[model samples]
Target: MTSIDASKLKLPLQMLLMGSATKLVAPKTKTVFIEDLPPEEVAKHAPEPAGLVNLGNTCYLNSVVQCMRSIPQLRSGLRAYVPPPRSANSLAAGTASSSPLLLSSLRDLFESLDRTTNAVPPSNFVMATKIAFPQFAQTGPRGQPMQQDAEEFYSNLLTVAGGEMRGNCLTAGLTGGQSAASAPTPEELDGAENLADALFGMKMEETLTCDEFSSAETAAAASSDAMDIDNNTALVEPPVTSYDLHRKLVCNIQGGSDASAQVNVNHLSEGIALSLSGKITKHSEILNRDAVWTRTQRIARLPPVIVVQFGRFYWKATPDSQDHAGVKCKVMKPVAFNGTFDVYEFCNEKNSKGLEEVERCSSSGGRRPYRQKAQGRR
Candidate 1:
């Protein structure tokens, strides 16, 4: 390759460089080599008079510092950036010098990178120089982290502040002998009719997907008056919201706790829950035997749990008591019933000695023992 000899050629700005360097005007130079000046070394030799590095030296060294700081991560990544060997490699690639703004722009680039990216010197130094920085331009809405930050910020806020209610469930408190309506439980707010859910951080969804809308199909059935009216006598009680229900006494019977627990649904909503003990009877004895016969009389009889769930669902409560239907919303949670008894053939009862199979009485809403399959419920 053809080459120019540095020894014989006159360099530009030679006299102004004014540094200790071998200069000459000879021919047949043996070699040409690049001597890199470290940024620190250049800074050390900047001409004191110009208030800038030596114009020639300054350009080279300024190029080094400019290349070092141009990385957004480098300057603000730490209290002070120290370029690592990997960062210095960028200078060898000569990327920063292409732009005239390189030196003036580097320090400012570090200022607005994510604040979490900033740290103390040694740790920040490696992260800033060795890794590429994320684009954190604050120029437009798309460039900002508004969506991610708002979600994270609200999540943190909920953790600190309490009193968020979800659905009909309650984390309510028990108190003294005050009527449940106005009882002052801790964290209790007044009538739900008076409050808004958005105030509780329940942000509105802009659109409901098809599946979300379909979930409301069952909810519509639940929000009706069918369960409350007494024409159908059954034990299923209405469901409740946290606001309308309150604890009056502690009766810890089932759970081995003297903890008195019962939910009063005086102002019962569309939801209701009830427990009652009764005998469940099917209309025909033939239907029971036929169902059993069709199934090949499985195990000589039905496994008793099936019979009990059927009994509980079908039990006819005494019509005098109010039938409080559970809230139709999410009320489909199967009603809780303690089935601690086995089914008995109605004729096999010890309470009836020599009882007739069918006892008939006059039609004044009186008792006529019909041939019926009954499940004794409690």
Candidate 2:
């Protein structure tokens, strides 16, 4: 055996240990594949876009957020949103100095998603959402988050976002130019002019007129019956006739008997038309007589975007089942629709005539028809 100098061995030992430590902490690199690239990268090469990570059973929330993010105007509005002060934010803001928790969380989430190529966890947003709306925090038997309806989340989020946007707009207006004396109260602010309304709100005029006065003879009969012989006093009024704005529309599912005749997108249009079409509803309030009323609705104004929710799940009668009451079942019907939908027929006289004029002008100008067609979506 030959004895070696300890000084020479010390340098070699230190170098070996240092090399191993560097290897342990160094970044690893692998061969890059186009197919395996993140969606943000793929989007540059293809049309693919990134997806969100499912936080528990938060697919409902993810779907709505993705849909909203797809809207350019909506994304721009949310990006521009500056959280109002705590005084203006009426929503649940955990801290006194913080903005509305849900809105702030949503804005932050969107920013994070736009910045990252990887799937976002949305954990903070989910926690903020659960704090703002306990309903979304529903727990299953195992104490995990339960699955929720997408439409319910969509509607609720829109309502909350709209309110916050409107409140912020009011605050901005006050701070920009309006004096405190001239500023309107929160109650006086218009609710129909928010970001949500600008992006997807629609106005509809609903007319409800009594059939009792529809004909001259029926009108005369009603008038005669309105007089009291003993008191010699007349009611001096007609059947209930009213008009108002409709904020929402409900589509009913309709189909034939055979399974092959299952409801489709056409059926959806028909259902909407049925609701807007004239229908006589029986009433028995006036003069102990069977009065009738005809109700109708027309599009007062159209929004830039339209949302169509299919009536998929329904409560079905299950007579022979153990429950023997009813069961919630999803409709297996295959609905088909083209890229464009013609809603010209559904508009009121003013809107219909306006569309016609626009079409004529466009044709005369050698441009594409100015017809507004709704994009069919599921």
Candidate 3:
């Protein structure tokens, strides 16, 4: 074989190796075809500009790049980051509308590419002012994205300041060509405002917890009505109305702690059912005769032997004034009411064993030490 030239081979080989190393280190554009990526994988990879910076290609993006280009299939990668518009609701964090500039840029680009115009992104304030509250804009000062009513005046002026109807603007239903009738006057508007304030302030229902009941302020409230009326006749007034009913809790829980849970609570699958209309009032009277909202004994001379009803049993009510004021009525095991609610489940029960015993005592002295022998449950 002929002797190789080392000087000639070394220069050629070194040039090739140095060029390869420089290509690996340099920030060269890495183009990817969307068709090459799986549809699901595109979202995972392309995502937004935040993820794009990791791909290292968000800056210097053209303001009006195509969504999908023809030649090498180039597209504005930033379009993927822009949020979806809402008239239709979506479970996305960027549901807040984008600025007008962003919308116009997107719309023109998409339309130029002959693509669908799905998103008309408006800022959150724009949505609130323009869409949710168009009437306010009709009354308040209007500027850019000018309403047609405001625009006619604007094109005439150099730059109008505070030029929208500040006075009360009105709209009337002219349709159906109604017979002569007068518009609602200023007196009606004042009444409407009062009604609005009342509605906004009202609460549907209220609840208090065990800790609330234990408060020193609440203890005074727990005092019997009779005592309160007698001691402070000038300050305390008679309970105008009262309702009551008695109900024995029949169902027993396997665990004592589970048994004592509030029956009305959301976690409980089974509910204490009662006749939806009159039952709560009837039950409330039997339990806490003094619960003013019940209205059961407000007029009547009170029935003897208030029966504690639950399921099939009418349990006995031994009149006692232990926890209550001296004036007592047959108290249900755990009575609850929210005006319209007929059944009350003692949400306050701490455990089940005590309740089970109470049920047995009330149920015509049914099984006293009711204990089931363990089978596979053991």
Which structure among the candidates has the greatest lDDT?
2
lDDT (CA) for every model shown? 0.25, 0.62, 0.27
- Superposing all C-alpha atoms, what RMSD in Å does each candidate have to the true structure? 34.3, 13.0, 26.2
lDDT of 2 by residue, 232-318 (tens): 333322444334433345454544234533444355567577657565766444444555667777776655566766666767677
Model 2 spans > 4 angstroms off:
1-46, 87-99, 167-191, 222-250, 254-266, 277-290, 316-327, 364-377
Ranking of models by lDDT: 2, 3, 1
TM-score against truth, every candidate: 0.12, 0.67, 0.16
Clashing pairs in 2: none
What lDDT, from 0 to 1, does candidate 2 have? Answer: 0.62
The window of 10 residues in a row where model 3 has the poorest summed lDDT is 157-166
| Count of steric clashes across candidates, in order | 27, 0, 19
Which 10-residue window of candidate 1 scores lowest in summed lDDT?
Answer: 290-299
Candidate 1 lDDT tens digits, 1-378: 899677887656344555656686567865632235544344435442112132211232222332333322223222232222334666778643222122123333333222122221222321232132222111245542221222222232223222222212121211122234543333333322111111221111111111111233433433243334333333222221111111111111221112322332221110111221112222212111211110000011111012111111112234465665332121112323322321222212321222222223354453343223222221
Specify the highest-TM-score model's number.
2
Model 3 residue 56 CA deviation (Å) reads: 22
